[model samples]
Target: MASVLGPLQPIVDMVTSPLFLQIVLFPGLTSIAIIGALLGWLERKLTARVQLRVGPLYASPAGGILQMFADLIKLAFKELFVPENSDAFFFIMAPTTGLVLGAALVGLIPFAPGLQIANIEVGLPAFLAIITLSPTLILLAGWSANSKFPFIGGLRALFQQTAYEIPLWLSALGVIMMAGTLNLAQIVAAQSTGWFIIPQALGAFIFLVTSVAEMERLPFDLPEAESEIMMGWQAEYTGVLFLAAQGPGFVKLYAFSALFSVMYLGGFLGPGFLPPLFWMLLKTLIIIVLIMLLRSTFPRVRLDQLLRAGWTTLLTLAILNIGITYLLVVGLPTL
Candidate 1:
């Protein structure tokens, strides 16, 4: 038995290495994808209940929890169709780019105490930069289609993300100011005294709204408005191509929810009864539910209204929050 197992031991050791486990298992790509799928079902179930309909129930006999996995399999087997006029290379490359960048953002987030992939000093900025990658991919996805509606939707994506990103970065600056560090794990530790939400409520609100726009979620989902633009930027995608384009959006939703929990909700810091990961996940789930509720609750905003809110309302509030946070950080020490 020892001789038989000897040859495979190195492979097993490599698979069980700390770096490999952190990158592939807990708080990694697989975990994020699984959680994203589960959240998708939860979103559907919640929206259905709101609309007085019963959501997925037959596929697995357990309220159709397996629906997402089944759908992924179906999409994987279906033919990928690229439009005759489309730029085949970029049309294929765009979604792959988005998925990779979105997953990269997960690597920056700390799941629990001593459970982060990398502990860079500039973790927050690294995260923000990785998030900004999506809009460029969105533009590519739309442009590669070589169609009018997709072109327009891609422009809208650029405009919307640009408008919101400033507020998102500035709002995060408020937390950074309070915490006095750009390291995410350190920021969570700072919150051992108190969560940033209490002092930076306005900034937190701005971050939440802008993140919705960044993710192109409901009420701010102008880039993919099905009724207005016929699936918009994703119109030319089919099968696994469609999945590649759409999967990142849900992953970003989960990523941003976790970001919010870590930044403003004290992250993994919580009561002793549960593991830190559990507390972190609970906070993130609450944010996810709140985000999903907006899907069925509100009508999509007009482009002008959406842009105006981002430029005028959110930006102004974010700036004010920064000033206020600066003052509290500077003044509170004297008392």
Candidate 2:
């Protein structure tokens, strides 16, 4: 085995070496951002399909693949309209803050075996900490905008964040309990026999649901409900600022999906025929698709219902999941 791995070791090194950090960071960020923007386009197209309407077909013949790019270009060159009443500093700061923080999270996640930018011992906790700041940034953006719609959107975002963060962290604790480590790579390795989805099925379910809420996708997207609040905190943003804010949403989705893949879907594990990076991307894409599907199928829930589901239903389920996993781990003998 040592001899066989000798030649292959260099390949691994080449892929994971420090010099490739730029390669990993840029392509990874670009790919994730593109996927997320595409997800928005996909959601529109898919929702249109469901509702029997055409969606953005004129942008490009290849089913509007260039639509997102076109939107990006437009947002880039379009003039930024900063409201007269707005606090120019934070108004300028908020969207970029959200985007930067969201993109920073990608650095902490592992893509495959020996393929990660940083592998801190407290990686999971670090990821949680980084993501928890998003809502505040949105709030700042909304408040700084000094507009009624944006302020209301900011308030809604604050409430939504408060409600969902608890369940999200609790669900994460369930995985921690089962895995016995905070390290993401270790957690992934612990699933050699079977994915956590089987033994901790309930936790996995809660995690998925709460994570979607955390991502502010459909059914829990009260913060940005257009009819109620006119795009919520982002109502005042336009042009590059709008694009920056939009960028974070995708980054967050990619980060959370990657984290979920690590926690439950046997991250980076696959047969010899396929590379580890391929497996990791495959798992992340699967989760992303499921999220998109949920967005397409479910109607947006009322704010009160969203709160109830998060605090009552999801919290109860996550707690029970941890209890059961604890009992199983304690009772079972080592093989």
Best by lDDT: 1
- Candidate 2, which segments miss by more than 4 Å at Cα? 1-27, 332-335
Root-mean-square deviation (CA) per prediction: 2.2, 6.0
Per-model CA lDDT versus the true structure? 0.89, 0.82
lDDT of 2 at 296: 76
TM-score of each: 0.95, 0.89
Q: What is the C-alpha lDDT profile of model 2 across 249-330, one tens digit per residue?
A: 7678888888889899988987879898888888988888788778778889887887777788887887888788888788
Q: Where is the poorest 10-residue window by lDDT in model 1?
A: 1-10
TM-score of 1: 0.95
lDDT (tens digit, per residue) of candidate 1 on 34-118: 9878877888889998999999887797998888888888989998778988899999999998988888888888889889887
Clashing pairs in 1: none
